[model samples]
Target: MRRLEGTVALISGAAGGIGAATARRFAAEGAAVVLKDVADPRPQAEELTATGAQAAGVVADDADERGWAA
Candidate 1:
């Protein structure tokens, strides 16, 4: 069984660099990923979705409390 099967992961700073890399790894492990970044996380999320992984992207600044209120 995949280690992350039936799991959901929310990764911050996922627009690029290590955060994006982690998002990809989690999806490969069979987790549905929710990627959040101040930048655009959609491209990474879309890439994962195209590969048949469950993924989504959110544009939000983690430091901003108001971002999550939406």
Candidate 2:
């Protein structure tokens, strides 16, 4: 059984670097991951999905309140 089965994780700056690594790790553990970043994270999300994870990529700026409110 996976540790994060039926769990959800929201990760910021997930388009690259540490955030991307975290996202991958979370997905591998069976968590549905939402990746938020100013840059498009669709490719990374798709990759996770291909590996049998439930994942989504959202483009937004964490520095902007409007970004999170939306």
Candidate 3:
């Protein structure tokens, strides 16, 4: 469907569960995913990236905007 073709998606709370599901969906639709979470997402992100999906994980507390800016 090319729902997210050429889009850059910043997904907050994306370390697992709903957030992770959304990231996967976005990637499947061709969006570049920027995952944000307080926990580490290296393994998940790497797995997704290996599947030809553009994905990267950023560890941060969602309460802080400064973290998002980084």
Candidate 4:
């Protein structure tokens, strides 16, 4: 079984770079992933889901509490 089976991971800055890589890894391990980024991360999230992983994207600015609240 995968290490992250039945788990959920919240990843910030998940549109690219380290964050995107990490999101892929987590999903590979069987975790449902929530990707948050200042820009739209829906495309990446959709790709993951298409590959049979559970994933979601949310537009958020970690520096802004209002963004978090939304």
Candidate 5:
């Protein structure tokens, strides 16, 4: 069994750099990922999904909870 199997992860800063790397690694470990970025998060989410992982993106300002409401 995979270490991250049946787990769900909420990750921020996933549009590039270290966040992007972590997202890939997590998915490879069999975890479902929710990618977040102030900018476009669709690409990263789509990439993970193509690799057979569950992924979704929500555009929001991480500093503001209102953006994440609901």
Candidate 6:
């Protein structure tokens, strides 16, 4: 569906498992996706992008409030 065509979703813990699945599902539903993980989520993002999805990956430590201070 094109319900999310103009949406942007930021998903944490997206390197694998549920978060990864959610990102893929959202992309399929037409949302631009931002995948965040402590580990590198770039590969998953790139894979989504290759399928003509708008996606980006971010390495972040959600535990550290300081890290998010940008």
lDDT, candidate 4, 1-70, per-residue tens: 8999999999999999899899999999999999999988889999999999999999899998888665
Is 1 or 3 the stronger prediction by TM-score?
1
- Backbone clashes in candidate 5 total 0
Q: Give the Cα lDDT of each candidate.
A: 0.96, 0.95, 0.87, 0.95, 0.88, 0.97
Point out the worst 10-residue segment of candidate 2 by lDDT. 61-70
The residue-by-residue lDDT of candidate 1 on 1-70, one tens digit each, is 7799999999999999999999999999999999999999999999999999999999999889999789
The predictions' CA RMSDs to the true structure, in order, are: 0.7, 0.7, 1.5, 0.7, 1.0, 0.8
Clash numbers, per candidate: 0, 0, 0, 0, 0, 0
Query: Deviation in angstroms for 22 in model 2?
Result: 0.4
Whole-model alpha-carbon lDDT for candidate 1: 0.96
* Best model per lDDT: 6
Candidate 5, lDDT over the whole model: 0.88
Query: Candidate 1 — which residues are off by over 4 angstroms?
Result: none
Q: Name model 2 segments beyond 4 Å from true.
A: none
Clashing pairs in 1: none
What TM-scores do the predictions have? 0.96, 0.95, 0.87, 0.95, 0.91, 0.95
Better of 1 and 5 by TM-score: 1
lDDT of 5 by residue, 1-70 (tens): 7799999998899888888888889999999998889888879999999889999877778799888676
Tens-digit lDDT track for model 6 on 17-69? 99999999999999999999999999999999999999999999999998799
lDDT of model 2, residue 4: 96
Error of 5 at 15 (Å): 0.8
* Pairs clashing within candidate 6: none
What's the distance in Å from true for residue 28, model 2?
A: 0.4
| lDDT over C-alpha atoms for residue 11 of model 1 | 100
TM-score, model 2 to reference: 0.95
